[model samples]
Each structure stands twice: as structure tokens, then as C-alpha cells.
Target: MRQDELWGEDTTQRYDTPGTGMFAPDVVEPAVHRLAELADGGRALEFAIGTGRIAVPLARHGVPVTGIELSQPMIAQLRSKTDEATIPVVVGDMATASAPGPFHLVYLVFNTISNLLTQPEQVECFRNAARHLIPGGRFVIELHVPDLRKLPPGQHAVVFTSGPGYLGVDTYDPLHQHLTSHHFHYTEDGQARLARSPHRYIWPAELDLMGQLAGFELESRHADWKGGEFTAESGSHVSVYRLGPVTAT
Candidate 1:
């Protein structure tokens, strides 16, 4: 499905999990705190700011926040919580969208960058982030490390999430760095539904190279929002890259 269709109205309605899963205070507060600190009292921009999950709370924390979102349905959901005056959002692709000037922080969380589904688009996303940031500003990305190790020699899929009412699996194309996450949701009535989305999984080293191509220097990488050490066993990372002089040719 296309990106917008994947996050259409039905999906948008189901996206917000207030006080649970990604919306739990423990999962969210630390990220908001860290982002506020990184903003350093300057304006912030969020790429793919879905349903104001972080932007609303962060704005409440006194940092000015703007967003770039492609899904109109998602943006509408966001509007239900806050007005455009409180947090203005431009509707366009994050890889090419333009928002108001020179934000101190530009962030893409929850592996949103991977939605671009191609190397060049991902590179453009880095450049786009750089374009929106002031020199010395920071670009932050939170993404998962591919779980190739979980696959047996010939297996191409891994079950990444399994819970009482849900099952999530990822099928991989190693040669193309592609992934399609399939989610199965079960209703109390015994009904089952499936949703799938495509992504291009990226490695830390390749991400750093993308940053460098957009004139950014690696600042720090942590296992989580709380600044935990990123060890080999870490499944995901929150990476910070600082804007520097443009050198991409």
C-alpha cells in the first residue's frame, strides 16, 4: 500500500494507544525530556508527527514544535487534540517537505525514516533535515536494528511482537534491505485483521554515512531514550547527529 493509504483514517483511529504501549508515560516521558533538552529552548520540528503523540506533550513542555506529515488523516487526528496555532504542521513528504526556518532540533522517531523505502529517499531525508536545521542544530532518529540474527539460515521472517491480542512479524529481503511488517490484531469477538507496511531497514554505519553526506557529525547513540549504553545486543537505537558545514558533492 502507499504510505498515505497505509496510515489512512482507519489506521489513524487505531494508532493512538494512550497510556499504553508507545504512549505509556514510561515510554514517552523520557523521550520528551530528552527532546526538550536537545531543543535547548529553541524551536523543534518533527518529521512524521503522527497524531501528536510526542509533539503535543512536548509543546506542553514549553518548546515550540512544528511538524511535517504526509497522512492527512493522521494530521486530522492530531488536530483533535491541538490546533494549528499550537503546533503548525505542513502536509508533505518528510524527505522533501519544507517547514518554517532553522529549527534547533529535527527528529524522526519510531523508525519513520525507513518508510521512504529506498536509499536515495533516505539520503534526501537527511538532507531535508539538514535544510531545516540551523548550523549546530541536531537531527535525531530512533530506529530498530534489523533482527537478521533471529532468522535461521534459510528463514526470511521473524516474529518481532507477540501478545495477548496481537501478533507482529517482519519478512525481510536481505539483498535489498527491505522489510514488510505484518500485524495481526485480534478482537474480543474472535475476529482477526491484518495490516502490513513496507520499510527499508538501515544499519547504524549506513545511517552515519547518510548524516555525513548531509553535513552532520555523529554526536551520540543510545540504546533508548534514557541514555542507556548501546551495546551489541541492543535491538534499537536513538541516534543524534549534529549539523555541520555542508560538504556533499
Candidate 2:
């Protein structure tokens, strides 16, 4: 499915899980705190600011926020929580859409960058973030490390989560660095539903190279929002890259 269709009405309806999963105070607060610190009281821009999950709270924390999102349905959901005057959003692709900026901070969280599904697009995403940031501003991303190590010889799929009501699996294309995540949800009424999304998994070093190509320097990388150590064993990371000062010839 196309990116917009994948996050269409049905997905948008089920996207917000209040006080649970990603919405848990423990999960949300730390991220908000870190982002607020990065914003440093200046304006912030969120790439793919779905449903105001972090933007709303970050704005409430006193940083003015603007957003870029492709899904109109998702934007509709976000509007229910806050008005445009409070948090303006430009509707279009994060890799190419321009929002009002020179923002102090630009962020893309929860592996959203992988949605670009191709190397060129992902590179453009980095450039887009750079375009919106002021000199020395930061661009933050939270993404998962590919689980290729978990796959034994000849295995192409891995089960990342298995629980009473849900099952999540990822199938990989090692040659292309592509992945398709399948999520199965079982209702108490014995109904089952499946949702799948495609992604282009990226390595940390590769991501750093993208940052460099976009004129950014790696500032910090942590296992989580709380500044935990990022080791080889870490499954995901929150990486911060800072744009360098612009110079004239």
C-alpha cells in the first residue's frame, strides 16, 4: 500500500492508545523532556507529527511546534486535541514538504524515517530536516536497529512480539535492507485482523553518513530517551545530529 493509504482512516482510528503502549507516561514523558531540552525554548518542527502524540505535550511544555504530515486522516485526529493556531501543520511528505521554519529542532520518532522505503528518499529526508533547521540546530530520530542477528542461516522472518491479543513479525530482505512488518490483532470476539507496512531498515553508521551528507554532525546517541548507553545489544536508539554553522565563500 502507499504510505498515505497505509496510515489511512482505519489505522488512524486505532493509532492512539491513551496511557498505554507509547502513550504511557513513562514512555512519553522522557521523550517530551528530551525534546523540550533540545528545543531550548525555540520553535520545533515534527516530521510526521501523527495525532499530536508528542507535539501536543511538547507544545504544552512551552515550545512552539509546527508539523509536516502526509495523512490527512492523521491530521484530522490531531486537530481534535489542539487547534492549528496552537500547533500549525503543513500537509505533505516529510521528505519533501516544506514547513515554516528555521526551527531550533526537527524530530522524527518511532522509526518513522523507515517509511520512506528507499535510500534516496531517506537521504532526502535528512536534507529536508537540515533545510528546516537553523544553523547549529538539532535533528533527532528514534529508530530500531534491524534484527538480522536474530535470524539464523536461511531464515528470513523473525517474530518480534507475541502476546495474548497481538502478534508482530518482521520479514526481511537482506540484500535490499527492506522489511515488511506484519501485525496481527485478535479481538475478544475471536476476530482477527492483519496490518502490514514496509520499511527500509538502516544501520547506525549508514544513518550517520546520511547526516554528514546533509551537513550535520552526530551529537549524541542513546538507547532510549533517558540517555541510557547505546551498545551493540541495544535494539533501538535515539540519535541527535546538529547542523553546522553556514559559511560564506
Candidate 3:
């Protein structure tokens, strides 16, 4: 699906169900804390800043925040939360859009980089982040690791989440490093609504290479926003790359 099409009116509205998965306090706090600290009292820019989810709170914490978003619906949803003076957003592609910045930190969270859907586009996103940062500034990304391990011999699909209200599954295409997520939302009337989005699953090492190509070096990587050690068993990672000479991993 095109990036803009993936997040329409209903989808953006459904994204912020307070206390649910992504919007839960516990899920949001650690991320804000980590990003705020990384900002080091400097400005921050968020790529694909959907609904101002992380940006608004980070700004309230005193970090100047700006965003680049491709979806007007998502941006509208964000606007509904806070006025333009609070969080200015540019409606354009994260991989190519420019926001006023030499920001100290630039971040893409919640597996948003995958939305680029191709290796070259994802690499361009890294370059774009580098473009917005000051020397030695950091770029952080929160992405899920591919779960090929869960794909048995010939299976191409994995149901990662299943509940009475929702079902989330991913279908993989290893030949092209693509994965399509299908989300099913159930209503009280026994009707199921579906939303599907495509992503390009990337390996951690591959991401590091993209950082290098964009003139960045790996600074640190963690299993989550809380800074847990990243390991083979981890499902997602928060990786920080700096705009300078390579750092020993």
C-alpha cells in the first residue's frame, strides 16, 4: 500500500485508543524518557510522526519538537491533539521531507522505517535523517526484528497477536524482504474490519550498513526503550546512530 493510503481517516482515529497497546502509559513513557535524554536539551525532529504520539509528550518535557509526516489524516489527528504552535508538522514523505533543523536528535519510532517498503527508500530515510542533524547528532530508530524463526518450514504467515477484539498477522515474502501486516478489528456486532500495510523487514546488521552509508556510526542498540541489552532472542530494538566516525559496536 502507498504510505498515504495506509493511514486514512478511520485508521488515524483508531490509532489512539488510550490505554491500549501503543498508547498505554507504560509503552509511551520509557520512549519519551529515552528520547528526551538523547535530545540533550537540544531540538528533536521526528520522522513519520503520527498523531504526535511521542512528539507532544517530548515537547512537554522541554525538548523542541518538529515532525515530517506523509499522511494528512494522521497529521490532522495530531493537530486535533495540539495546535500548530505546539507541534509544527510538514506534510511530506519522511525519506525526503525537510523540516527546519540542525536538530540534535532525529528519530523514527514504532517500526515506522518499515513503511518505506524498499531497501533504497529505507536507506534514503537514513540519509534524510543525517541531513537534518548537526555534527555528531544522533538518529534513533525503534524497529521490530524479522521473526523468520517463527515461520516454520514452508509457512509464510505468522499470527503474532490474537484476541477477542483483534487479530494481527504478518505474511512474509523472503525473496523480496517484504512483509504485509493484516489487522482485524472486531466489533460487538460480530463484524470484522481489516487494515493492511506493507513493510520491508530489515536485519539489524543491514540497518547498521545503511547508517554507515549515510555517514553515521552505530552508537548503541537496545532491545527496547528501557535500554535492555539487544540479543538474538530480542524481538525489537532501539538503535542509536551518530553522525561521525564509526564507533565500536
Candidate 4:
């Protein structure tokens, strides 16, 4: 599907449902705290800042936050919450868009880098973040580790999430490292609605290589924003990369 079609009006409208699931206080606090600490009273820029989910709150914490977003509908949803002066945003692709910056932190959270859908684009995303950062500045990414181990031999799909009213599955093309996440939300009357998005899944080591190519060095990697250990069984990670050299804190 086209990028615009993927995050168009209807998706933007339904994107935010505060204080539940991924929007829960507990789920958001760790990321906010960690990013705030990284910002260290300097400026921050968010890549693909949808509906200001993190940007709004981060700005309220006193960090000057700017964003680059491609979807106007999503930006409208954000503007409904605050004005441009509060949190400025540029409309364009994250991999190529330049936000006026020499920011201390440039973050792409919630697996947004996967939205680029190609290895070259993903690498460009790293370079874009580097371009916006000051020396010793940080670029962060929160993403899932492709769970290929869960896929039985010859099986191309796996159900990653299911709940009372929703189900989510991922289909993989191992040869190309491509993935498509399929989500279904059920109505009370038993009808199901579906949405799908494509992604190019990269391994953690591959991401580090991209960062290195973009003039960043791996600073730290955690299984979560809370600084949990990333291990063989961990399914996701929060990785920090720094421009030039940084002594890990």
C-alpha cells in the first residue's frame, strides 16, 4: 500500500486512545523518562511524530521538541492538542526531511523506522538523524527483534498479539527480510476490520552497522526503556547511538 494510504485520515482518527494499552501511563513513562534524561535540557526532534503521543508530553516536561511527519491528518490530530509554537513540526519523510536542528536527541520510537520499508531508506534514516544532531548528540530507536524463531519451518506467519476485541499477526518474507503486520479489530456484532502495514525487519546487529555507517557509535541497548537487559529471548529493544564518541553513562 502507498505510504499516504497507510496512515491516512481514518487511521489518524483512530490512532490515539489515551490511558490504555500502549497509551497507558506505565507504558509511556519509561520512554518519556529515558528520553528526557537523554535530552539533558537540550532540544529534541522526533521522527514521524504521530499525534504528538510522545512529543506533547515531552514538551510539557520542558524539552524543546520538534518533529518531522509525513501525514497531515496525523499533524492535524497533533495541532488539536497544541499550537505550532508549542511544538514545531515539519511535514516530510523522516529519511529525507531536514528539521532545523542541532538537537541533543533525535528519537524514532515505537518501531517507526520500520515504516521506511527498505534497507537503504532505513540507513538514510540514521544519516538523517545524524544530520540533525550536535556532536555527541544521541539518536534513539525502539523496535522489535524479528521473531523468526517463532515461525515453524515452512510457515510464513505468526500471531503476535490477541485480545478480547483484537488480533494481530505478522507474515514474513525471510529471503527479503520483509514483513507485513496484519491487524483485526472485531465489532460487537462479530464483524472484523483489517489494517496492514509493511516493514523491513532488521536485526539488532544490522541496526548497529547502519548507525556506524551514519557516523554514530552504539552507546547502549536495553530490552526496554526501563533499561532491562537485552538477551537471546528478548523480543524488543531500545538502542541509543551517539554522534562522534560518547562515554556510556
lDDT of 3 by residue, 37-61 (tens): 9999999999999998899899999
Q: Give the C-alpha miss distance for residue 58 in model 4, angstroms.
A: 0.4
Tens digit per residue, CA lDDT, model 1, 48-115: 99999999999999999999999999999999999999999999999999998889999999999999
Give each model's whole-structure lDDT: 0.94, 0.95, 0.93, 0.93
RMSD of 2: 2.9
lDDT of 4 by residue, 34-148 (tens): 9999998999999999999899989988999999999999999999999999999999999999999889999999999998888999999999999999999999999999999
Clash count, candidate 4: 0
Model 2 per-residue lDDT tens digits across residues 1-249: 799999999999999999999989999999999999999889999999999999999999999999999999999999999999999999999999999778999999999999999999999999999999888999999999987989999999999999999999999999999999999999999999999999999999999899999998889999999999999999999999999843311
**Residue 222 displacement in candidate 2 (angstroms):** 0.7
After TM-score superposition, what is the CA distance of residue 199 in candidate 4 from its true location, in Å? 0.8
**How far is 4's C-alpha from truth in model 4 (Å)?**
2.0
Clashes of each: 0, 0, 0, 0
Worst 10 residues of 2 by lDDT: 240-249
TM-score of each: 0.96, 0.97, 0.97, 0.97
Error of 2 at 87 (Å): 0.5
Q: Which stretches of candidate 1 lie over 4 Å from their true place?
A: 245-249
